[model samples]
Every structure is written in structure tokens, then in C-alpha cells.
Target: MTPVVSLRGVRVAHQGRTVVHAVDLDIQRGSWFGLVGANGSGKTSLLKALAGRLPFSGGACLIGGEDMIADRAGRAEQFGFAPPADRLPDSLRASEMLAFVGGHLDRVRRNLGPLRQALGVDPLLDQWIGNCSAGMKQRLAIAAAFAGGQKLVILDEPFNWLDPVAIFDLRLALRQMVDDGLTLITALHDLHALVVACDDGLILANGKKRIDLSHGMLRDAAVAPSLFEKEMIDILRAGAAE
Candidate 1:
């Protein structure tokens, strides 16, 4: 079967400086994929490119067999994204913001019931986004992302500001989504969560693709957190040395 998402020789640049080098990748259908990288390693850049927020300077991005850049509406219909916490609008109420971000998509409206139930957003609906606590904001953001019943969901730094209980709840929610055939991708620093949740993961260092770990490799790392942390650190170190 064709991959759900594909990147070929992709390159991204900002302000005349290249941030993501030529990179190639494929994300399978119905799988939870993880993107890992140190600060400024181009993880967000790649996600933005995939989300159509940023234009790619070279190569191609395909979503569900359609060229992502060339087929804007198709790409938009196929994926939903949750940006970082700091990027959410503070001016609107939680309900207003969620509506503003996802209201146009029919899938979002159709899928909102499950998201509302899972993220527990009813209490925060009337609250102004700026007034809500950090955890509240994060929960709303998550609700907004999963609200779209797109084939693929991309989330950046999803666990930020979440308490232990919220984190546990979110993980269960993600697992349920995957079980229901949603393709999930996230760029996160929570190594333990990544290992526990993702079937596959890629590590980026200095805008370069450094390592791709399969399910067994990721599961193995979970046996010892330090081992996985050390491996990520080593990848970054290697990139820095180059």
C-alpha cells in the first residue's frame, strides 16, 4: 500500500538560510510516528512544511498520494495540526478559538464530540484562552487538533504544560485514536512518551536526518531511559561535530 505521507529530497529555508536539508521520508498509514530533534534542528520546520504553513524550497511533499504543495486543498483535508502552546490565540475564548481554527473543516465538526469528551473541554469552553491555566490551554489545543477527523494528525510539543494526570489521559486518547485508524505524528521532547507511543521515529540533527528507529528499537530503548537519551545526545553530538 502507498504510504500516507511522503517527502522526497525536501529542503526548507528561512531568511535565506537553509534549515532543513534534502530529506526523504515516508509515514505509513494507521501508525503513530515521532519526530525528534534538539533545539533548532528543523523538526518544526519540517512539520510546518507538511502543514502548508511554510513553503518548501526543493523536492516534494505528498499526502495520501497527492502532491502536498501542488494540491493545497487535498493536503488540508487530509491532515490536522496542533501547533505549539505559545502559538495559540489568547484573545478568544477556548470555544471561539477552537471554532476559528477548525470550524471550516467538516471533519472537524464531525469529530469534535469525541475530542470534547476525551480532552474534557466543556469546562473551559466559556473561558478566555488567555485567562485559562497552562494545562487548560494545552487541553483545548489538543481538542482542537483532534477535532478534525483527518486521516493524519500532526502535533508539535503536545505534552507541554500538562500535569501527570493530563499526560496519562492524553496518551490514552492518542492510543484510542490510533486504534481507530488515525495516523498520528508528533514532534516532542518527551522521550519516554515517544518510545511508549510511537511505532516509528526519526531523529534530526542540525537540519539533517540522523536516525530512523523502528518499533523494536524504540521499545528496546524504553527498557532504559538513559540508553535512549544517550543515543539522541550522541546523534546531536555527531551532527555538531560535523
Candidate 2:
């Protein structure tokens, strides 16, 4: 079967500075992939490129066998992209927010009750999202992303404002989605979350991917964490140089 997403020789630059260079990646259908990195490691850029939100220098990114360069919108709409775009209506209730998401794709399933509980947004669903806490906002964002029921979901720093329990619930929803055949790619900060949620790991640093490790290796006592930290520093220093 064709991969849910594929990228080869992908490069992204900004203001004459190369951010991501020659990245080749493949995300299998129904797999949950993790991206681990420090700031400026090109994690967000790479995710955006894969989501077809950024133009790349030289490469092909195929989404569900459709080339993004050739048909960007059609391909992009097939995947759920919850960018940190602040695109939500602040005054809307959580239920109203999900209603908007449902309306976007003409979905009749306005039953956000279950998902709200699953994502732990039940208590805050009727309140204005703008007045909610940061974790609540994060949960709302995630709810919208999954609301559309797209085949692929790409999330960047999705754990930014989430509390520990909310984070775990999000992990549960994500894992359930993968098991149900939706491709997932996420950038997260907590190591414990990553350990529980992902199988294979991709480590990015200095605008490039430095390591791809098995779940066992990532959980190793003297292996994955050490190497990942080193790569993260490399990325941080590289950013400082620039």
C-alpha cells in the first residue's frame, strides 16, 4: 500500500536561511509518528511542508498518493492540520467551535459530547474558549482537528498548554485514531508522553533529521535520550550561529 505521506529531498528556507534541508520521509498509513527536537530544529517547518502549508525548494510530497506540488488544496483538505494559526473564534463556546468544524466539511455528526469527554473538555465545553485556560484552549484546538475526521492529522507542539492528565487523554485519543487507521504526526515536548504514544521516532536537529529509532531503543536507559539531547543542542547552537 502507498504510504499516507511521503517526502523526498525536501528543503525549506526563509529569508535566505535554509531551515530544513533535503528531508526524506514516509509516514505509513495508520501509524503514529513522533518528531522530537529543540527550538529551531526545523520541526514546525517540516510539518508545515508536509501539510502543504509551505513551499519547498526541491522535493516531492505525496499525500495519499496525490502530489502536493501538483494539487495542494485538494490534497491538504484530506488531512487535518491544526496549526497554531489562532484561527479560532475566541468568543465561541467549545460546542460552537466544534459546530464550525463540522460545518466546514458538511459533517452531520455534531455530537461532540463523546469527544469532549475523551479529550477531557466536557467541563469547559459551554464556556467561551477565550476565557478558558491555556490547557483548555489546547484541548479545543485538538478537538477541532479531530472533528473533521480527516485521514491524516498533523499537529505541531500540540502539548503546549495541556496539563498532565489532559495530555494523557490526548494520547489516548491519538492512539485510538492510529489504531482506527488515521495517520498521525505530532511534535510533543514531554518525553514520557512520547514514550507511551509513539512507536518509531524521528529526531530533528540543526534543520535536519539526525535519528530514527525503534521504540525499544527510544526507551533504552543509556541510548535514545542521550543521543536526542545531543542533537537538540546541535540544533540550538546552529540557531545561535544564525
Candidate 3:
């Protein structure tokens, strides 16, 4: 089967400075892919470019066989993205914010019922986003991202600020969604969770792809989390030195 998403020679720049450099990637349909990188490693930039929130150059970004870079608006409708919680509108209630970001209030509402319950954001819907705790805001943002009923969803550090139980619940929910044919991609800092939850992953260092972790690699990583983490650190260090 054709990959659900593909990137060829992809590059991203900010204010005339190159960030992501000549990256190529493919994400299979219904797979959970993880992006792992340290600070200023271009993970966010790549994710933003893929989500059509940032302009990129020098490549083709295809979603479901269509070039999304050439027709961002049309292809972007097929995916939903949740940036860091700080990007969320604090002035609105959680419900209003969801509707704004998710589009089609009725559809958002319809899809949010189960999502809100799964993410434990039901009680927070009426609360002002400004007043919600970081964890609460995170739950709301996640719920909003999923409420759009998109085939693909991209999340940035989604497990941040979530409690253990909440993290567990979200992981289970994501696994179920992927099994049900949703393609999930996330930028993650939690190495253990990345090893456990992701079917495949890419590691970046200084805006360059340092390592591509396959399914077998992730399975091995799951068995030796510390070893995997150390190896990743070594790879990142090598990249940084170069």
C-alpha cells in the first residue's frame, strides 16, 4: 500500500536560516510514528511544515498521494494538529476553543463526546481556558485535536502535564484509534513512552535525521529502555559534533 504520508528532500528554514535539512520520510497508514529530538532540533518546524502551519522548501510533501505543499488547504483538511498548550486561546472556554480549532461546531461536538470522556476533559468544557491547569488545558487541546475527525492527527509533546492515569488512558485511546485506521504522529520527549507507544520513530539532532527507529528497533528498545536511551544520546552527540 502507498504510504499515507511521504516527504522527499524536504527542507525547512526560518528567517533565512535552514532548520530541517534534506529530510525524507514515509508514514504508513494507521501507524503511530514518533519524532524524537532535543531542543532546537527542528522537530517542531518539521511538524509545523507537515501540518501546513509553516512554509517549507525544496521538496514534495504528499498526503494520500496528493502533494500537500502545492495545495495545502485542500490536503490540510485531512489532518488535525495540536500545538503546545500555550498556543491555545486562553480567553475562551474549553468548549469554545475546541469548536474554533476543530471547525464545524456540530461535528466537533458530535466527535468530542467520546473523546472528552476518554481524555477526561468533560468537566473542563465549561471552564475558562485561562483558569484551567496545565494538565487540564493539555487534555482539552488533545480532545480538540481529535474532535475534527481527521484521518491523521499530529501532536506535539502530547503527554506533557498529563498525570500517570491520564497518560495511560490517552495511550490506550491512541492505540485503539490507530487500530481503527487513524494515522497518528507525535513529537515526543519521553523516550520510554516513545519506545512503548510508537511503531516507528525518527530521531533528529541539530535539525538533521540522526536515526530512524524501525519496528524491530522499537521492540528491542522496549526491552532495554536505558540502553536505547544511551544509544540515542550517543547518536545525537555524534550529530551535534559534526
| Per-model TM values vs. the true structure | 0.90, 0.82, 0.94
Ranking by TM-score: 3, 1, 2
Please provide, for model 3 over 1-242, each residue's C-alpha lDDT reduced to its tens digit, 9 standing for 90 to 100: 79999989889999999999988888999999999988889999999888888888768898889887766566567778885787678899987887777676677866654465678766887899999888988888788778788889999899999899989888988888888888999999889989989999899988899878999999998889999999998887888787
Model 1 bad stretches (over 4 Å): 71-74, 104-110
Number of the top-ranking candidate, with TM-score as the measure: 3
lDDT top scorer: 3
Candidate 2 stretches greater than 4 Å from native: 85-87, 104-115, 219-242
Candidate 3 global Cα RMSD: 1.6
Question: 1-242, model 1: which lDDT tens digit per residue?
Answer: 69888899899889999999988888889999999888898999988888777778898888778777665456656678875666678898877777677665454556764565667777787888888887888887777776656668888888888888778877887888787888998998878888888989898889999988788899889898798888788887898677
**Candidate 1 has what TM-score?**
0.90
Ranking by lDDT: 3, 1, 2
The model with the greater TM-score, 2 or 3, is: 3
Q: Backbone clashes in each candidate structure, one number apiece?
A: 0, 0, 0
lDDT of candidates 1 onward, in order: 0.81, 0.71, 0.85
